[model samples]
Target: MIRFENVSVTYEGADEQHQPTLREVDLTVPEGELVLLVGPSGVGKSTLLGAVSGLVPHFTGGTLTGRVTVDGRDTRTHPPRELADLVGTVGQDPSAHFVTDTVEDELAYGMESLGLAPGVMRRRVEETLDLLGLAELRDRPIATLSGGQRQRVAIGSVLTPHPKVLVLDEPTSALDPSAAEDVLAVLQRLVHDLGTTVLLAEHRLERVVQYADQVLLLPDGVMGSPAEIMTVSAVHPPVVALGRLAGWDPLPLSVRDARRRAGGLKARLEGRVPAGPDLSARPASGKQDPGPGPGHGKGLDGGDRVGRSDGTGRSGGFNPFRRRRTEAPAPAAAPLALVDALGVRRGRVEALRRIDLTVTPGETIALMGRNGAGKSTLLSTLVGMIAPTSGTVRVAGRTPHTTTPRELIRQVGLVPQEPRDLLYADTVAAECAAADADAGAEPGTCRALVSELLPGVADGIHPRDLSEGQRLALALAVVLTGRPPLLLLDEPTRGLDYAAKARLVAHLRVLAADGHAIVLATHDVELAAELAHRVVIIADGEVVADGPTAEVVVSSPAFSPQVAKILAPQPWLTVEQVEEAL
Candidate 1:
């Protein structure tokens, strides 16, 4: 269905010619096959996907030295518009793909452009709406939807056209775990039931590796089965990592396969307790002694509050507000942020409601829930992007919604869902320089952070030219330059590989050790396992679950990490934890 012959691409540079992003790539993707393209950030995965849709040379203004054909049509001669009927491409940013105001119209726009019959278009639109669970949101304007909702609309729009080939770059990056599973299930149906060809590039291997028919490891452009490639690939999922740590032959791609082989390893770790990080300390609360098991001490239940008392004469029902001065045993340090009975409304929808959360110094909290379940809204509320409809939100003791930007920068910094939103400079060097000046930091401080997060990134390269992961790193560096007391990140690991994510985890740990509070809204369960001390789950704009990371995540099947799933009934949340216990 797709073929690449001696393909090499290079982009013209201003002062000096740039290196080839893709070199000597030769491959063939058969019909009805799902080919997962895996590689580290900036390793030409997106560039290769663009080439298949005829966006590299014709639209992106790059040089192509080799022949590329899709469905027996040469991509060199056929532009994106010409191949629209045969191929549908969804880029990293789903908002960029929007051409209409409402979800239903966006889904129908592609079919209308193809001049499908009215009856056919209507039927396809309804099917797509049902398939993607956009039925209730069909008439809603796309602008009001959350990032993950926009992603579903973007995908549903393409699927309505019934294209033979789908070229998706990080299709599930913005989706929550359940929504990701739904999207992947839709793709699986398309491939098996309709014989559709899918070429997808994703950084989160754990979500898609099991669904892939073949793995195409990039830069080298080597293609093989998932088991064949994961054995040597630098980028991999937690289940594969666990398989490797346990010395299991032929690494497993899915949790079920790994679970079948994890029996012996589980027995080895039966009584041994994992020496995970001790993050039981809460704001205004004294240090909590380590418990007998993982995450057992000082963990808050869903209904438990810091000082609120139940009839049993015990603190219960979590009240994420300031305690009265009359309370005994005063807090050691004030909370970095406090949200009390928070409510936010966007249009007719209630984005958040009666939500209560607190960020303590040195705490790393992970905000998790289904897509469009108010995770982003809660983050925006914390960062002061959205004003609360009711109740109060304070960051560093100052009201975030009313605080000045200049003053807010020092107390709290937010890296939004779209990393590009925080970036405006042309070149990477200029961005870093501006961040340093904005934060009043020493020279090269931001650049040094960028180098640590994203090594080997050239100073002269335009921020637009960097990969999604690279842009995120640059944005994170810009935010970290200020060294704010509280940090807010939304989907921080969207496009990052395992190695890059590890670096990010290490950096955040260092920041937490320095007494900086960190909160990230994410769908990456593995990230929560590796980094979060506490997990807060939002559902339908309310706080449904809140507790220590292990206690909260392991109880929910959808939110559990692969390692935890493989070694069930055990408190181990990561392969590293199991290894440490062993």
Candidate 2:
């Protein structure tokens, strides 16, 4: 019911600056169908949503050279209020969109806005509360909710209208595995049960690919030519990374489909299903021993990953000259470390209870939990962003609370769930420089760190204009400017494509080999398997399970994947590992 015809947008920049962000773009969405807006960051995915919501010219002060019609009305003619009934939108940042202080009132505000009767509003509010599993938090203040809970309220506020179309931009980027599942389940039901047309704008392809009926490859920059961005196309489902690597034509949209296809293909290729990676034995060095060589990095910079295991070393090493080999990782020791008691609180609600844990260095730690499980709160408290309400958190020998953020910067760097909070600079160079400065190092040294973290940041572009992956890279660049020994990434892979995710994993490996500890909080099981050395399942502010990644992921039936691996989901983390087993 929404259409973009030769639409182009030009926005005024700093001090009367004018530039086009989207070219003459053409797009169409049928009713009761699902479409995915897919591309890298800053590709105008948000701008496309703005066009449908009538916020482009009114709020952005832009020139519109084409037509955007929603529900048959020209977007140019209808104000946002007029179109509010037909379409609902959720921005990428859930915190930025909350309209009220409490979850209950937040849900009711939009209903009241539309002049619904109080009785009708009450019924809808109750229904939405149950639908999103927010009934427990209905009366809770919005400020007290976790990132995932806040996002649920955002979705509920919009769904109350029962609009014909729903638009969500990276709804799960900030959530843990359990909480992300909760929000995604609600969206799935909206399409299958309510027949609400869904248009999701996201870069995290693995999460939504399974359900999308259509895939639109939006353009990368501003211009009205429709030359590159917003290239809409039909897509058949397959697992995102698998399809990309196997070069499957008509990439699959779901993990189930990908599993079946992978099984059949592997059976056809090597006459058997791919066995899981052999974790029983100490993994061979997949690459050369760490020392100065052609591939070795200067100082702490990681050496090029051997592109492929040539019976001597591992693949995916930092080798800019050679093509990257599509392979999986070899199994190694699970990362572990010691912890005494850890606890944190937000206002009156306890974010984390008395907790104890230990993970080794050079391991990927997957912290899985439901919304409000206190995963992020724990991470923040650990990294000194917020002090612990009680107990202690440690990296090596120092407690973060006992040390300043500056001190932690050299030992523990935190990549926030929402990366934009750290990106306020006018330019990429300035932001990276600021990050370098915050790390208490010289600007030149920080610049070198930025090049290593982001790999391809130019000097003149606005940091805001960079891609989602680039923005994360920039934030990480700032976080790691001091070469911290412990890095806590709160969903670093959220909203990233397979390529971007792979790159992030590669970066983590680079840092880990140099002895940095990595703890990632995410809802993505697939990502955890591929990257994490261990898995920790958190429920109700306590770590319910902690073990090797394989042991924990498979033990929890609900969190385990149905993907047909040579082994179950947990034991075999990457495609290369599976292939090696086979």
Candidate 3:
């Protein structure tokens, strides 16, 4: 249903230069198959997706050689609108695709644009709402919906058009585990039942690897069976990594398959126990303990001593599962930040309720909940972007709301859900230079950090032209340049592959060890498993559960990572932990 013949994409660059994003690629996506396109950051995955929907050269102002066809219609001859009936494209940012205010209306907007009959539009809208499990949210305004909900609405909107080919970029990147499964299930039904062609790109492979019919390896643009491609691919999910470590001949794609082959591996790991204190056994005390020291080599200085709740100062450690010592020693320093009785109202909606939170130095906290559970709202409030309707937020002993931008940049830096929002300069180099100048850091500091986070990204490329993962890396570099005492990142792993995520986790650990408090609003349970010292669960704008990572994630079904789920009854959280035990 989709074909790319001898295609090459080149974008305009400095000095009238042209940079090739895709080089001499030939591909064919059979009808009714779910094809997963994956590669390293900035390796032309999104560019390839854009070509299928005719956005590459036409809309993006790039030069496209050869041809791309969807459902036998040449994309070059037909613009996006002309192919709208046959092709529906949902991008990484769902908000950019929205044209209507309400969920029901958003679902109907595409059909309306296609000039469908009102009755047909109504039936399709209802069917889509049921198909994607958006029935309860049909009447809700799109602005009030959570990130995951907005993603569902975006997919449902395009689905209403009944396009033969659906093109999606990171469709489930924002969804919680259950929500991601729901979205993937809907895509599978479209492929199996209706024979619709679904092409998608996602970084969180653990969630979607099992559902793929075939894998399209980019850069080289090689296509093969999922198992075959996964064996050689670097950007694979945790399960694939685990399979590799265990020496499974054919790597298992799904958790079920992994479990079937895990018997022997499990036997090998039978008597092994994860290193660290037993989180459940550790009693809650007034004073918190300072756990393991830093692991990230170089650049980060881990010499700062954190005062324990008991008033004893100790060097930082890098244990991922360390519990936060709640009760500091009587003479200990105050928390780096505090949120007391925080309430925020956005118009008629209560975004955040009376929430109380504390962040001590050197603590890595994961703020997790269903999408729209006040996670982003809380982050915004902490950074002074959103003024709370009531309650007080203090970071570095100063009110975040009343602090100046210059001071706030040094005290607390926030990376919002859309990383592009933080990028403003023309090129990556310019952005990095600007970040250094703004943060009063030495020249090349931001660029060096970007190289550490996302290597191989050209300095001259426009920030807008970089892949989602690369943009996030640049944004993160920009934020870290200030060396803020507190860091707030919302859904930071949206487009990062496994390797990128690993780098981020390591850097975060180093940051935590260096006495910087980190709070992340994310749907990535696996990240929480690997990096968070404390897991804070929010629901309906209230803190439902707050405890050490193990206590919180292992107790909840929706929040547990794959390793935790596989090795249930055991306190393991990652492949590295499993490896360490054996």
TM-score, every prediction: 0.92, 0.79, 0.91
Q: lDDT by residue for model 3 over 62-164, one digit each (tens)?
A: 7899989888899899998888889999998888899888999899888888889999988998899888878877778777777788888999998898899
Where model 1 places Cα greater than 4 Å from the true spot, the runs are 14-17, 278-330
Q: What is the lDDT, from 0 to 100, of the residue 179 in candidate 1?
A: 83
Alpha-carbon RMSD of each model:
7.0, 9.8, 6.8
> Which residue pairs in candidate 1 collide?
284-331, 303-317, 303-318, 304-318, 305-317, 305-318
lDDT of 2 at 276: 29
Q: Measured by TM-score, how close is model 2 to the native structure?
A: 0.79
Q: Of the candidates shown, which would achieve the greatest TM-score relative to the real structure?
A: 1
Q: Write the per-residue lDDT of candidate 2 for residues 1-582, one digit (tens) a residue.
A: 888898988755511334566887877777887777776555577778878888777675668889999889898999888889888988766777887888899999987888999999999999999887788888788767766777778988998878888988887676544556667788788888888888787665555655666667756322221112222222111244345556655555555556656755464445343342222222333321211101112233221100000000011112112111112344243323345677665656666776776544554577876666767776776665666666766666677666765455565666777677777888877876676566556766555655655455566667665655667766766666666666777777765655555556666666665656678887766667665666677666776776555556666654554332423433444555444444
lDDT (tens digit, per residue) of candidate 1 on 292-366: 223322210000000100000011123332221111243477888989999887767877888887777878888
Judged by whole-model lDDT over C-alpha atoms, candidate 3 comes out at: 0.79
Worst lDDT 10-window in candidate 2: 304-313
- lDDT accuracy of residue 46 in candidate 1: 91
As a TM-score, model 3 comes out at 0.91
Pick the winner on lDDT between candidates 1 and 3: 1
